[model samples]
Target: MSAPASPQELRKLIAASSWTGPTAGVLDGYQQANLAVVPRDLAFDFLLYCNRNPKPCPVVAVTDPGDPVIRLGRTEADLRTTLPRYRVWQRGELVAEPTDITAYWRDDSVGFLLGCSHTWEGPLRTAGVPVPHAADSMAPPVYVTDRPTHPAGRLSGPLVVSMRALPGHLVARAVEVTARYPTGHGAPVHIGDPAGLGIADLSTPDFGPPPRLEPGTVPMFWACGVTPQLVLPNSGAEYVITHYAGHMFIFDHHVDETP
Candidate 1:
């Protein structure tokens, strides 16, 4: 249908398969979420993983085992259908990328909603920072770094980061603005050269497209929610589902509502 006016409207559009694209730069005042659903057996391990790597896997809302709803008691949003797209992983390999995961939903599944960097892109724009991926259709480049997060149980993977190029003067201001939203990855983990993080090339991201940079603008990296997707493959889980990179779940509440 027409463009969604609010977060709830965007979610409705996504659920109905009307808007199945990157969720960044939409519903500016509301928060966006990265979704991870794993088996009940591995739930504790994933919970511990999130606790250990709070920057990339900051836990916002988690659903009870087998529940498809977000369980914040705010709305009837169904986890199986709210996000624009989902990645279904089985036996360490991705099996499907669907607009909705109705057939994939299981009774033993648990949904964990992690904070997304897209949540703070709105605030950054409000603060006059130029974010190149400000369009809803744009997805920022993500790279797997040499820095490894503290392992918890069976989950251990190199840190994955999303990149944004900013002018020299605006980098510090961008950090200052985003640091207020800890749940949304806080601030830049590394700035300038990507090689410091073991990234061989900025153009060859492990996920999403290449970086959008102008002359005099340097690349700044932020801890990414996609880190969980990388961790889950080696976690020995039989089945896992997550939102497609950059296609986040739109939350009705604002970022301040998160703890």
Candidate 2:
């Protein structure tokens, strides 16, 4: 199926289960985000955690307790069913990956919309930097790095990063292009040598697909929105919900716009 032409249409398609693939190139020029839903008891801690770890968890919109619609910007996005896929967790264990979570929605639930790097792909392409994942129509490989995030209350875990392979010569340009979007993981955390970040093998990632690189190319790593999912297990939260990898909620703002 062809990609949706606008953010609203994309959400509509997602709500109808007509599109379940990664949202990389969909609704270009609009911002995309990762979704995290946690119980109210741990909501403040999770919010503080995101505040501390802004690079990996920059928040775009947050839903009021028990409200599925995010009260941010001008869009009426429904958190429980707008994303193409959702993952349900029970005390850190992934129990189900469903297309909608309305059945699991609770009055005490709070949703967080975190910035996504896919928002930078359009600018990268315009800047003459190649985005391999976009070209291949796949999600970048996301690894659970050895680096630890700042702990807030009971929420703490290792940092997660998404790795993209770019031509060695264009790495600098890629960095420059992405740096302009601070909320979207501003710049890469690591440029080369995945081992430095405790990533043992590029072929094996904690989430998403394996990295694909051409000769004379380097792997560029950026803090990923998936960081919250990694922290959920460590937080010991009895119930949690997150967007399935690469299937994000699209917003109406451009990457540079504050939401």
Question: lDDT (CA) for every model shown?
Answer: 0.87, 0.87
| Candidate 1 structure lDDT | 0.87
> In model 1, which runs have C-alpha deviations exceeding 4 angstroms?
none
Instruction: List the candidates' TM-scores in order.
Output: 0.93, 0.93
Q: Which 10-residue span in candidate 1 carries the lowest summed lDDT? A: 68-77
Per-residue lDDT of 62-131 in model 1, one digit per residue for the tens?
9989989885646558999999999999988999999999999999999999988888988888899977
- The per-candidate count of clashes, in order, stands at 0, 0
In model 2, state the lDDT of residue 16. Answer: 92
lDDT of 2 at 113: 90
